[model samples]
Target: MKVGFDGKRATQNITGLGNYSRYLIRLLTKFHPHNQFLIYAITIPPPELAISEVEYRYPGKQLIKSYWRSFGIIKNLLRDNIDLFHGLSNEIPYSLKTAGIPTVVTIHDLIFIRYPQYYSFIDRLIYKYKYRYAALHADKVIAISKQTKQDLMHYFGVNEDKIEVIYQDCDVIFHQQVTSLMKDEIKKKYQLPEKYLLNVGTIEERKNLMLIAKALLRIDNIHLVVVGRETKYTLTVKQFIKQNQLSERVHFLHNVAHCDLPAIYQHAELLIYPSRFEGFGIPIVEALHSGIPVIAAKGSCLEEAGGPGSIYIDPDDDVELAKQVKGIIDNNETKMKMVRMGKQYLDNFKSKLISDQTIHLYQNVIDNAKR
Candidate 1:
């Protein structure tokens, strides 16, 4: 079988959607080497992802490059005789179904619909239209979490059977145990506190980094290490830190190298993720794989991502967040229990298992299309 991918994020983005795209390709090639794979992208893939088994194709003309995936990529798929096309992002070429190719689209989240206030008006409109079109037209729709699947049915009225829930795995680097020497070196390089809580994700309003900063007021000794791209929301968090005189207690490490992330996770006491919503929290999985306990927000798909073993606190409650942090820090037995449980929960998201399931879906779609 020949499979093609919408590789925009795969080639260009280093995080989130890009990681998913690259990891999927990596797993499929590792576990199902018999099939041919093609990556369609306007930009060249980064050096780190220059895999030999995959063929890369670009748009024919610069004029069409901006919207090639939605408009002009079908011709390329047909030219390559692609038996299956997977949109690793939330959209596929609008003409893919019309071209009679079996298509699958991975919808990461419907947060724009679920929390409209968090997104701009135009973004919400565009996402709704693109998501609805892909969900309606694709042969199969893959939702990253059960919450996302439910959002598809509720917001767009997509049929239940049309959506499949597939969880994503963290990078293999997180699964490796870092040596204490390497941990100390990375900690020294980053000037991380001797004991600190970690938070990984964008510094955006919806991520709710302020809650974690507020929690710091009630807790002592332990600092908070935040790593991610900063947005305007970051200023609000910084202002809160200044007003509360937490300059020394909260550290923001922006654009840290991906290779160094595991050491940071390995040396951390725990991960605190207070996001208001998520499709799936990859950081929680990374924490679990890194053998660290996680304290994440309650009342969303985080429970599904962090699993039952991880602690959950109300997103709005800073007092409760402080208490959980202190409790986990003071009680070694409880922290160890959470770590053990998290490790057990991570088995369900093993890369090979997810890859095989995705391959099965592709085969089913192809067979049904042929009939």
Candidate 2:
């Protein structure tokens, strides 16, 4: 089978949606080697993400890249005789079904719809049109979490039967053990404190990094090491940190290499993710596999990511957040037990299981098309 993917993010992005596209493609090629995979992108994928087994396709001479991805790509899909096309992002070509090809789309979240305040008006309008169209038209909708599946149904009136809730796994590197020497090297390279909590995500308003800064005030001794892209909210948190004299207590590391992230996770005492919302919190999963206890926000899909063993507190309650951190720090046994349970919970997100499920969905869509 020749399977094609909308590969804009896989080639162009390094984090978030880009990571998802690249990981999914890598998983499929590694596990289902019998099937041919094609990545259709505006630009060729970076060397690090490029797979030898897969073919990369681009527009021959068309300069308008976004237009080609949305409309012109359908012609290439037909020309290549792609058995199925999957939109790794939130959209598919507008005319795929009309051209008689079965299609699938992965909807990461409806954050723009759920939190309009976080996005520009034009972005919200564009996202709603694309996402709603894909949900209503695609042969199958892959929702990364049940929360996202529910959001699709509620926000776009998508049929529940059309959606599949498949969880995502972090890079295999996180599963590998980082040696003490490597940990020490990373620690020295970053000037990391001996004892520090970790938070990994874009420091944006929706991510709610201020909650952690507020909690840090009450807790003593341990510092915070934040690893992610800085946003305007970062300045807000910095202002508060300066005002509260937390310049030494909080360390922000941006653009850390992907390979070094697991070591950072390993060295951390705990992972505190106080984001107001998420589709599926990949950092929580990374922490689980890295053998650290996690304290995440409530009222989102974070529980699904953190599992029953990890701790949770209100996103707004810095007092409770501090209390939970203190509890974990004071009790080594409790922290270890949470780590143990989190690892056990990871069985549901094993790479083989997720890969096989995705392949099966593709096969099912193909079989139905035949009938």
Q: Which predicted model would earn the best lDDT?
A: 2
Quote each prediction's TM-score: 0.98, 0.99
After TM-score superposition, the amount by which residue 300's alpha carbon in candidate 1 deviates from its true location, in angstroms, is 1.5
10 residues in a row with least lDDT, candidate 1: 44-53
Question: Candidate 1 clashing pairs?
Answer: none
Tens digits of per-residue lDDT, candidate 2, 240-259, equal 99999999999999679999
For model 2, state the Cα shift of residue 133 in Å: 0.7
The models' CA-based lDDT, in order, is 0.92, 0.94
RMSD values, in order shown: 1.0, 0.8
- Deviating ranges (above 4 Å) for candidate 1: none
Tell me the lDDT of model 2 at 107.
99
